[model samples]
Target: MAKRGSRRAAAETQRRRQTSGRRGQERTGWRLWLRRAVLWGGALALLGALFLGLAVAFAARSLPSYGALKATQPGQTIVVRARDGTAIVELGPSPGKWLDSEQIPEVMKDAMISVEDRRYFSHPGVDPIGLARAVYVWVTGERRLQATSTITQQLARNLFLNSNRSLDRKLREGILALALEAKFSKQQILELYLNKVYFGGGAYGIDSASRKFFSHDATELSTAEAAIIAGLVKAPSRFSPTADVDAAVDRANVVLGLMREQGRISASEAAVDPSAVKLKKDVSQNSVRYFTDWALPQLEILLPETFEPIEVWTTLDVGMQQAAATAIKGNVPRGAQGALVSLDRDGAVLAMVGGTDYVATNYNRATDALRQPGSAWKLFVFLAALEAGYTPEDRVKDVPVTIDGWSPRNSGGSYAGEIDVRTAFAYSKNTVAAQLGNEVGFGTVASMARRFGITTPISTYPAMVLGSSETRVIDMTRAFAAVSAGGNSVEPYGIVKVTTTAGDVLYQHEGRNPTRLVPDYVAAGMTDLLQTAVSTGTGRAGQISRPVAGKTGTTSSNKDGWFLGFSSGITTGVWMGRDDAKAVPGLQGGTAPARAFAAYMRYAVKDRPVEEFQTDLQLPEWQLEPDDEYYYGGDPDEYYYVDESGNLVEPQRPGPGQSPQDPFPADGEQPPAYPAPRQPQYPDESGQAASDDFLDRATGARPSPAPVPAPSPRTRTLTPPPQPQQTAAPRPF
Candidate 1:
C-alpha cells in the first residue's frame, strides 16, 4: 500500500510542469507580433510624409495656362532689309512662319524624337524609366550622365520653368509636364515645341532654321538637313552650320545613328551624306552684317523700344558694300587692318567695311576706331585761315618755327622756305601749318574743325595742326561730306524709312533740309584746295575716273594711314593701321589707303553720272601768291611789337581767362618795318631787350580793301574740272 502512493505523486508532478511550459510559449508569441506591428506602422508614416510633401510642393505653384500663352506672343523680329528690298538680316529672333504638324517633315520629327526623347509618344509627360535610370546612375556612378527629361518635360521646362536642377524644380517640372500632356495631344505638343525652340544664329523655329541653315522650308528639309537642325537643339550656337560647319556635321551624324538605333529609320535611310546637304551661304556673311550692325543702334531713334515686327528700309547699297569690302580686303597689306566707310552727301551710309573678316571679329573699326588725323587735319587749318581773310596764295614760310620754346620741323627736316598756302597744302608741309596755326590763334583752328563736324577733342598745342588730335573715320567722313554737299552740315543717317508690319510709317528720313555750315566762297576755296591735293599733292593716287577731291594723312612712325576724299555723289574714308598702335613699316597714306580709296570710289561711282563740285566764288590770283600776312594774322586794332633790330612782331594770344595789355607804345614812337624773319622766333620775355617792346608798325597802314559781295544761295556755278596730268609721286617725307 505505501509503494503505490509514491508512484501516483510523481505522475502528478510531471503533469503540472507540462502545463506551466505551455503558458510561457503563449507570452513569447504575443511579444513577437506586437514588435512587428510597431515597425510596419513607422514605415507607413514615413512614406505618407514623403507623399504629402510632394503633393504640397506641386500644389503651391500655378502652372502656365494655355490662355496666358495666347496672350503673350513672342517678341516681334526687326527685319533689316537692303535698299533694294532684299532681306538682309533678322534682328530680334527667328521670324519663321508657324507650320502645323502636317507641314513638318517626317524625317525631322524622327530625328528630334530619336535624339531628344525616344519614348516621346508613349511617355505621360515625364518618363518614369528614364528618371529611374538617371537617379540610379547619379547615386552609384561618378558622373550624372543619364538624360531624364522627356520631350513633353523639356517643352514644359522651356516654356514654364527655369532650367534649375534642384529637387523642388524637378518635381515641379514633372508635375507641369503632366498638366501639359493632359491638356494637349502629342501632335499639338510636338508642333508647339518645333515652332518655339531655338536653333542658333538668332533663329527661333524649325522653318526659320531650315531657311537659315539649308536655305529652304522645314518640309523641304532632306534627311541630313533634318538631322543638322535636330542636333542644334542640344546647343544651338555650338552646332550651328554657319558658326561651325564641321561640328554641326558631326553632331548631325550622331543624330542619324540615334535614329537608326531607335528603329525610326532603316540602316539605308540613315546613310545620308552630310556633305551633300550643302549649307546655304549665310546671307549675313555676304557683307550684310556690316550694314545691319551699323543700323542696329538707329532702331532706338527710329521706333519705340517695344518689340513689334517692323521693317527697316536702310540706305545700304549692297553693290557698293561688296565693292568696299573687296577693295579693303584686296589692298590692305597682310597683318595690317583696314576700314572703309562711304556715305551720300546727306550722310546716308552707303557702304561700310569695318575689317577683313566680320565673322572673325565683330569689332567695327570704321565707326569705333579713334586715330590721329595726321596732316589730313591741315584741311581745317587752312579753312580757318580762309575764313579769317587769308587767301590760299598768301605765303607762309616753310622755315622752322618756334612757339613758346616748342619748335616744329618739316617732314624731312628740310625747309621749303617761303611758299604759298596752295603749294604748302599740296605737299602737306608741317612747318607752314604750324606758322599758320600761330597766326590765327590755335583756338580758332579748333573752332573751324568743330564747325566742319569733327566731334573729337582738339588740343590747342601747335602740334595739333599736324593732325595730332584723335578722331574717328565716320566723324571725319561726315565732315568731308560737308565739302561734298557744298558746305551743308550733314548729320549721318542710316535708316531711310521704318514701317510696321501693319504698313504704318513710323519714321521716315525723307531728306535733310539744306543747313549751310560755311559760306559759299569758303566752300569754293576749300574745293579748290582739295582739288589741288588730288591733282598734284599727297592724295594724287586717290583720284578716280571723274573729278575727286580729298586729303592724305600719316601719323608718326607709320602708326596710322588715312585717305579721306569725295567724288560728286559720295564721300569715303579709308584708314589702315595696326590695332596695337605699333608701326607698320613702309606704310603711308598715299600708298595702301589711296589705293583702297581709289578702288572703292571707282566702283561706287560707276552708275552715277559725272558731276562737278558746285562753287560760285573765284579763287583770287593773289590768294595763291606767297605773302607774309599768312603767318601773322592779328586784330587790326591790336598793337605790333618792335624788336631791337627794328622788326615788327605779333604777340602770342593769351591763354583762356587772361586779359591783354594796352596797345599804345610808351614812347609814342612809330612802329618798325613789316615782313619780319621768315622763321618765327619765340624768345623768352626775360631774355629779350627793352627795345623789343615797342609798338611801331601801326604808322605803315595801307588803304582798306574793297568789301566783297555777299554770296547768293541760288547762284551755283560748276567750275571746269582741272585737266589730269601725270600723278605726282608721294614724297617719303
Candidate 2:
C-alpha cells in the first residue's frame, strides 16, 4: 500500500513539473515575437527618415507643383561665349522638353513613358503595384528584375539619394517617392527628368546631347531619333554615340518595341530597323583640357576665400575652344604632344587647348611648359639692335659666325650668304643675330627682353639669340602679344567677371590695363618684322585671310616647336613636343602647328571683322637709320684695335649701358659668356673666323676687355621672350 501511494505522489509531481515547463516555453516564445515586432518598427521608422531627407533635397530645387504651373525656370540655359562676345554654344534643356509640358510633343510623352515608367500617368509619384510586382519576382524567380522606380522617384534619387543599394536604402527610396508625389505633378516631374539626365560625352543635358549625337535641335527628332534618345535614358554611357553602336542599337530596338506596345507608334513604325540608324557622328567636341584645367585655378582666385559653389563667368568661347583643340590634335604628329592658346587684343584668353587629346592625359604643356624659345627670341635681338642703330632694311651677313668663342648657325647649315635684317629675322638665321647681339651689346638685348616682360631669370649668354634659355609658353605668347599691342604689356586673364550667383558684380576689368615694358615703336617694329614671317616667311602657314603676323621655332632635333601669331582679331600661341623632353624627330613649327593655328582662327573669329595692327605712335624712327647697316651701326673696333696701352682702342667710348667686361685678361682666357660651347654648333670652325672680320675695328660700344678676346662668329647671344606677370592682378572683364 505504501509503494502504491509513493508512485502516485511521484507521478503527480512529474505531471506538475511537465506542465510548468510548457507554460515557461510559451512565455519565451511570446517575448521573441514582441522583440521582432519592435525591431521591424524601428527599421520602418529609419526608412521613413531617410526618405524624408531626400524629399527635402529635391524640393530645394523647386516645388514640383509650382514648376508644373510655370513654363521654365530662370537662368537654366548657360551660354558659353567667345572673347568677342559671340555665342559659341548653348547648354541645358534637352529632350524636346523646355523645362515645361507645353513644348513637349505627344511622341516625346510616349517615349519617356515607355523608357522610364509605363504606369507613370496612372499613379502618384510612387507606384505600389509596380513595387509589389518587383518584390514578387524577387522572391519567386532566380532572375530579379530591378526596382521599378517612377519618374518622380528617379528625380528624387537624382537630386538627393546617392548611389547606395542597401535594403534600408530601398525602403527609404520608397518613402521619398511618396513625398515627391505630394510635392510635384507628373508633368513637372517629367520636365525635370528630361532636363537633368546625363547623356555622356561631357554633356550635362538634352540640348548638349542633341548637338553632340545628331548635331540637331532636340525639337526636331524623327521617330528613329526619338527612339534612340529614349534608349539613352537607361544608361547614357552604354548608348552614347561615342560608345559601342551594336549595344546602343539593341537598346534602341527595345525602346521601339515598348513604344509599339504602349500604342504610341504602329508596329510598322517600330519595324524600322534600329540597327540601320546612323550612329556615327562627324562632329567632334574639342575638349580643351588645358583651358579647363587653367580655368579651375583662375576660378579659385576669382571666388571669395570662402567655399561656395558659384558659377565662374569665363571668357572661353566654345567654338574657338573646339577649333583650337582640333587644330592641335589634327596637326600634332604621332607620338608628339601640342598645345594652343588664343588671345584677344586686351590679352584675354579667348580659346585654349593644353594638350592635343585632353581625355588621354592632363599635362598642360601650353602654359606650364618651360622650353627654350629656339629662334623666336630673334624678336628681342632685333629690338635691341634697332634701339642701338640697326634697321630692318640693313644688311647682315648670314654666314657662319661666333661670339665670345661660341658659335650659332641656322638649322640648315647653308646660309643666304648676306641678307637684309628682315630676311634674316624671318629665316631665323643664327649667325646674323649673334653678330647683331655682339654689335649692340648682349646687355642691351637682355635688358630689353626683361623690360618687355621676360621674367625668366636671365644671364647675358651669347646663345640667348638662338632662344637657348628656358621660358614658359605663357611668357612666350605674351612676348609676341606685346609686339601686337604696340609694346603695352598686359596680363592675360581668363576670368572676365566675378559675381555671386545672384548677379552682384564683384569685379570688372576697366582702364588701359597697361604695363609699359617695351617702347611702343620697338614693339611696332617687331610686329612689322613678324608680318614678314606670316606672309612669306617660316610662319607662312599661319597666314589667315586677315592680316596675320607670327613666328615659328624648332629646337634642336625638333625637341620643341612653336608658333605664335596675331591677326586683327586675335593673337595665338602653339607649342608641340614630347612630355618626357624626348626628341620629336623632323617636326617643324611652320608645317603642322602653324597650320593648326590658322585653321582654328578661321572658325573662331568668323563673326568678328578682321583688324590690322595699329601704328606705333610713341617713338618714330625707333630703328634710327631705316635704310642701311653702314654708318649707323658700324663696329667701332673696325677702325680701332686694342693698343699696347690697354685702351679700348675702339672709335667710340663703351656705352654706360654695355655689360660689365669680364675682369680676366683677353688673350687665351675663360670668359663669362653663357653656354660656353660644350659642343660647337657652327658648320665650319675655321670658316666662322672669317665672318668675325667686320666687328674688328670696333667702333660700336664696348665695356672693358675680359678673358676670351672679341667674339668669334661662332658665339651667339640670345633675347628672352616677354614675361607673363609682373604686378598685382588687374581687373579683367
Candidate 3:
C-alpha cells in the first residue's frame, strides 16, 4: 500500500510540471506575435504619413507660374489674297487678353457657361460637384458625358497637358487648376482659355475661330451660333463642324439643353438654330489664292529684298469670290471637296478658291489635283477633229468600239446611234469623242494639246479619247483659253507687270506673238459647237447674256464633277471631288458646280462690256497639215486646207502644178513657219548685255536675246522731199 501511493504522487507531480511548462510556452508565443503586429503597423503608418505630406508639398510647389499664362509663339504667316485683302493669322501683340467680358458677345458667354461650366461664377478653380461626378465615373468605369468641363480646368489642361487622359494626368490637372487660379484672375483665366483653345481643324483662338467656323465675324454671331462655339470648347475636335459632324450636332444639342436648363435661353431660342448651322465654305490656296500660290514663288525672284511683305494686287472681286467659295463648299455634299477657277479675257484670275478652307487643310483641290477630264476633255477631242477637216455636219457613229482594249460608254447608258459631230461635242457624248480621238491619232491630239500649252502628260490609251487623261484645273482653263483666243495659243501669264513697291517697273508681260495652233475656220467651227453647248446642251447652266461654250463631266462612278466653259473673253472650270478619293452620295458635274458656274457668271460679267467670239470676223491665210489618220494607207487629202496662222481664208498663192483647191501644207517649210529654224543660241555683239548678277546665275546656256536698238531718238525727223530725188537719179542711170 505504501509503494503504490509513492508512484501515484510522482505521476501527479510530473503532470503538474508538464502543464505549467505548456502554459509558459503559450504565453511567450502570444507576446512575440503582438510585438510583430505592432512593428508592421507602425511602419505602415509612417509610410502613409510620408506619402500624404509629399503629395501636399508636390501640389503646392508645382503650381503654374505667370510665364505659363503667355502663349507660346510658333511660325507666323502672312496670307496675300487675290483681289481680297490680306488675312493675317498670327500672334499680334498677344492682343493683351483675347476675350473681354465686355467685348465678348453675350451669346458666346452664355454658350460657354451653358455648355462647359454651369456654375462657373459660383465655383472655385476646381468644381467640387464636377470632381465628385468625375469620381463617380472613375469608380464605376463609365464613360463621362462630353459636355462636362470646368473653364479654369480646361485652360489648365490646354496650357500644360498633353491630350492623353489617365489617373496621373487627372491628378496633375487638378493641381494645375489650382496653380492657374493662383496665377490669374477668373476673367483673365477665362479669356486665356477662350483664345488658346482650338475649335476644329487648325483654328486657334476665339477671334480666328469665329471667322473660320462661321464665315462671319465673331461679333456677327447670333445667339444660337454663339452657343455652338461655346459647345465646341468641351470637345473641339468632336464638335467641329468639319471633323465629327454628328458628334458636333450632338454636343451642340447638349449645349442647347443646358442653356435652357440654366434659364440663359428660352426653349424656343435654343431651338432656333440646330447644333450644326448651315456653314459657308472657306477660301483656300487652291481656289481663291489661285494666282497667289503661283505668284508667291516667283515674287521672291521679282522682288528679292522686300518680297517678304509685298502686297499683291490681283483681279479677284471679293464678293464674287465669296459666292464661288460658298457655292463650292455647300455643293460637294459630305464626301467631296470642290474647286473653282474664274478668269477674265486677259487671263486675269477673278475668283479662285482651291478648297473649302486653307486652315482646315493645305491640299489645294484647284492647283494640286490632277483628274481625268472625263467628258470635259471631249472638247479637246472634237477640236482635234475640227482641225482634221471634219466639219460640224460630218456624221459620227456612236457604236461600241474597243481600241487597244479601252472602250468608252455613252453617259447614262444611252447612245445616239448616229449623231452630228457638232451635236456630239455640245452634248459631251463619250463614244463620239473617243472615235474622233482614235481617228485623228492620239499623237496628233497630244501634239495639238502641247501647242495649246497643255503640259500635263497625255496618254495613248483609248480612255484618252473620252477625256481619261489626267489634267489640272489651271491647265484646263488655259487650254480652253486657247480656243477663246481665236485659235491662237497665248502664254498664260499670271503677272501683267511686276513693279517694285516704289512703282518702278521690274518686269512686264508684253503681248507676245500668239502661236497659231489651228486653222481659224476649224477653230471657229469648234467655237460654234461650244456655243451650242452653252445655249442648248450640257453647259446650258453657264449661259450668260452673251454667247458661251462649256462642257460638263461626271467621271465613272460619279467620283468627280466638272463644269468648264468659255465666254467671249473668259474660260473657267469648276471641279468637285473628295480629299479621300471617295465618291459623294449624289453630286454630279451638271448639278451644283454647273449652278455655281451659272451663279458666278451672273455677277462676274455684270459690269463688263459685251464682246463676241473671234469666229464672227474675217481671218488671215493658213495651211492644213496632212491628216495623221490617213498615214495608215488611208486617203491623205481628206482634211481641209488652212493657212499657217490658223486663218480659214484661202491661200494667196497655190503650190506649183497643183489645183488651187488643194490646201495641204505648202510643199515644204516656208520661211517663218513654225518648226522654223530657231534663232542661234548665241547673240550678235550688237545685242545688249545682261546684268552681271543675272549672267552669273545663268547656267551653261547663253542668255536670252539682248534688247534691240535703243528706242529711236525722240528728236529724229524724216524728210519726204528726199525720196523723189533718189527715184529721178535711178531713171537717169
Candidate 4:
C-alpha cells in the first residue's frame, strides 16, 4: 500500500511540472509579440510627424512676410468727388479709413461672428471637429450641413491667398491662419477682417459701408444696419442695400435670426423692423459710377503715375444724375436698356446714366456702344444743306427714289409730293432726306458730320441720309452742344480739378478757347428747324416747360430709339435699345426716348435761367428750280417723273457714251432703270423685317451703282467755287 501511494504521488508531481512549463512558454511568446508591436507603433508615429512638418513648411513658404501683414497702407487710393464736394466713388485698394478694434461697434462684431463663424472664438485656427463634419458631409452628400470656414481662416485667405478651390490653396490657408493666430490676438484678427472685407458699391471696410448705405459713421450704426453690413460678407453685390434694399433686408433678417440663436442678441432686439432701416437717399442712385468710371481713366491720363492718393473733383451734378437715372429706369421697357448723357454748353459732362441698373451691367453705353442713330443722323444732312446756302424753306420732292436699286421708303409707305426742308426734317421724311442727300453730295455731308465731333466711321451710302450710320450717344450729344453754344466747338470733359489728398493741385481744367464749327447764321437756321421739330412734329414728346429743341430717331424694326435734345444750355441724349440689337415692337424714339428726355430736362433746367434759341437769321431766300433737261415739263405740281406703275422715278443720268434716253445704263450703273419699283416694304404686325435696313444697299445682294462720272469737262464752268476748308480743332469732351 505504501509503494503504490509513492508511485501515484510521483506521477501527480510530474503532471504538475509539465503543466507549469507550458504556462511559462505561453507568457514568453506574448511578451515577444508586445515588444514587436511597440517598435512598429513608434516608427509609424515618427513618420507621421515628419510628414506633417514638411507639409506645414511648404505651405508657410507661400505666405506673405510678417511685415506685409502688419502694414496698414492701401497702395494708391483715388477718391472721386462730385462738384458739390460729396464723395461719389473710390477706386483702388482699401479705399476707406480702417477702423481699429475699439472703433468697431460691438454689434457689428457680434453680427459678423454669428453669421460667418459661430465658433469663431472657440476654435484654435483649425477645428478638427468641424473638419471632420465637413469631410463626412462631402462623402455622404449631406447638403443640409455647409462646410464652415472660421474667421481666422477667412482673414488668411483674404490677406495672403488667391480665391482658388484647390487642396494646395486650402492647406496654405489653414497654415497661414494658424500662423496669424500665433502672431496676433483674437481681437486684432477680428478688427483686421472687419477693415478688409468688401461691401460692394465701391465700399470697402465697415466704415465705408456704413457711410455709403446709411450716410453715417460706423460708430452710429443701428443693430439692423450692422446686420445688413454683416450679411454682405458672403456676397457683397448680391445683398448690397444700394443694389436691392428688399433683398438686403431679407438677408439682414437671416443674420438677425443667426445672432439670436447664438445668444448674441435678445429676441426683442432681433425683432427690429426692416422698415426702420432707411438707406441714404442717394444710395439707390449708384448709376453715377458709370460717369466716375469714364472720368477715372481721363484723370489718370492727365496726371503722372504715382502711389500718392488723389481727390478728383468732377463736373457731375448729383441732382441731375439722379433725375436722369430715374427717368431712364422709369421709362425703359423690360428686357431693354437705356443710356443718357448730359453736357453743358462748354461740354462738361453733368450727368451720365449708362444703363437702368449699374449693378446689372457696367458697360458704359453712352461712351462705348455704337448704334444706328436713325433720323437723329439727319442733323448732319440738314447742316450740310444749310452750309450749302439752302434755307429751311427750300422745297424738295418727297418721292420714292432708288439709288443702285436700293429703295428707301417713308415710314408709312406714303409720300408728300412737295415739302419744305423744315417740314421734311420735322416729319423725319425718309424720301425727302434721300433726295437731299443725292443733291448735296455724301462727301460734303460726311465732312459736316466730322466738323460737329462725330468720330465714328460714317458710310457715304445713299441710305445713310435716313440715319442708317452707327454713332455713339456722347458723340451725338457733343455735336448738338455745338449748336447750343452758338456754333462753337464743344469738347466733353468730366474732371474739373485733380488734387492730392493734401490739397496740392495736380491738374485743373481751364476753359479752352472756342473754335467756330459753323457760322452763327447756319446754326440759327438749324436751330429753327430743330425747334420746329420739337414744337410741331415727331419730337413733340420731348417738349418741356421752357423752350427746348431736339430730334427723335427710330431705326427699322425698332432696334434702337434715340432723342438728342438741348434745353437752357444743357444738351442731353437718351438712347433705348437692346444690346443684341433685337427688334422691340411699338418702340420709337418719339415715345419712350422722348419722354425720358423731357422727364430729365424738367429737373436739369429748373435751376437754370430760361434761354431761347436764336431763330431769326439774315439769309438769302432759296428758290427751287426744276431741271427741264431731266423732267418732262408741265404744271409745277406735275414736275415729278413717275414710272408706268405710278411709282415716282429717279432721273436717269447720262452714262459713258450713252445719252439720257438709253433704256439701260453701263454694266452696273443705276439698277436696270427701277426693275420693279422695289414693292415698298412695310413693317408687319411684329415690326420685324428680313431686310437689313442699315446696310441693305451696301450688301452685295444687289449690284452697286457706278460712281457718277466726273463732271463733264464742258460743264466745269457751271460749277460754283469750292468752299474754304474748315478748321480741325481737338475735340473738347
- Model 4, runs deviating above 4 Å: 1-68, 75-79, 88-285, 618-733
TM-score (all chains, Cα) for each model: 0.62, 0.52, 0.51, 0.58
C-alpha lDDT values of all predictions: 0.75, 0.66, 0.62, 0.77
Question: Which is the leading candidate under TM-score?
Answer: 1
What number of backbone clashes does candidate 2 have, counting pairs of residues 3 or more apart or in separate chains? 36
- The segments of candidate 2 whose C-alpha lies over 4 angstroms from its true place after superposition are 1-286, 306-309, 610-733
Question: Please, what are the lDDT tens digits per residue for candidate 2 over residues 1-733?
Answer: 9999999999999999999999999998999999999999999999977877666666544544554534433223434444565544444433333435666556766877898889998886778798788888889895666677788777767665766877777666666666666666677677777776667655544555666677766666667777777788778766765556676778878888999988989988888876665654533333644665676566445555633324446778777777787888899888988888777778788887777655345567777778777777777888876655444555666665545566565564566665677787787777677777776667777877787668887667777677777777777787777778777885777767655557676655553658876666557667767888778788888877888888887777677888888887578888888888788776777878788888887887688886876643333321222221223233324355545553544455457787633323345343113322222234344333222333342423433232222211122222211111122110000
Look at candidate 4 and give me any clashing residue pairs.
Answer: 491-732, 491-733, 492-732, 492-733
In lDDT terms, which candidate is top? 4
lDDT, candidate 2, at 353: 79
Better of 1 and 2 by lDDT: 1
Tens-digit lDDT string for candidate 3 (574-620):
98877665676666677777877777776776776777765542322
Q: Which ten residues in a row have the lowest lDDT in candidate 3?
A: 724-733
Tens digit of per-residue lDDT, candidate 1, span 1-733: 6888888888899888888788888887898899888899989998976885565445434544554643345456788877898877777676488878898989989999999999899987888788888778889886775556888878777677778778788777777777777777898889888887878777777998988877778879889898999999999867777767788889999999999999999999889888678777865665568667778787787677766789988989888888899999998877889898898877889998888886655578888888887878887888776665555555556655465455666666676666677778888887667667776668778888998888878898767788888998988888888878878888887888989889898888877587887666678778878878889998888988788888999988888899999986799999998888888887789989999999999999988899887644654332322222222333444445565685566557667998755333356533222222132353443333222112223333342222234321110000111121221112222
Provide the lowest-lDDT 10-residue window in model 1.
712-721
- In angstroms, give how far residue 412 of model 4 lies from its true place: 1.3
Error of 4 at 464 (Å): 1.6
As for model 2, its CA RMSD to the true structure in angstroms is 13.1
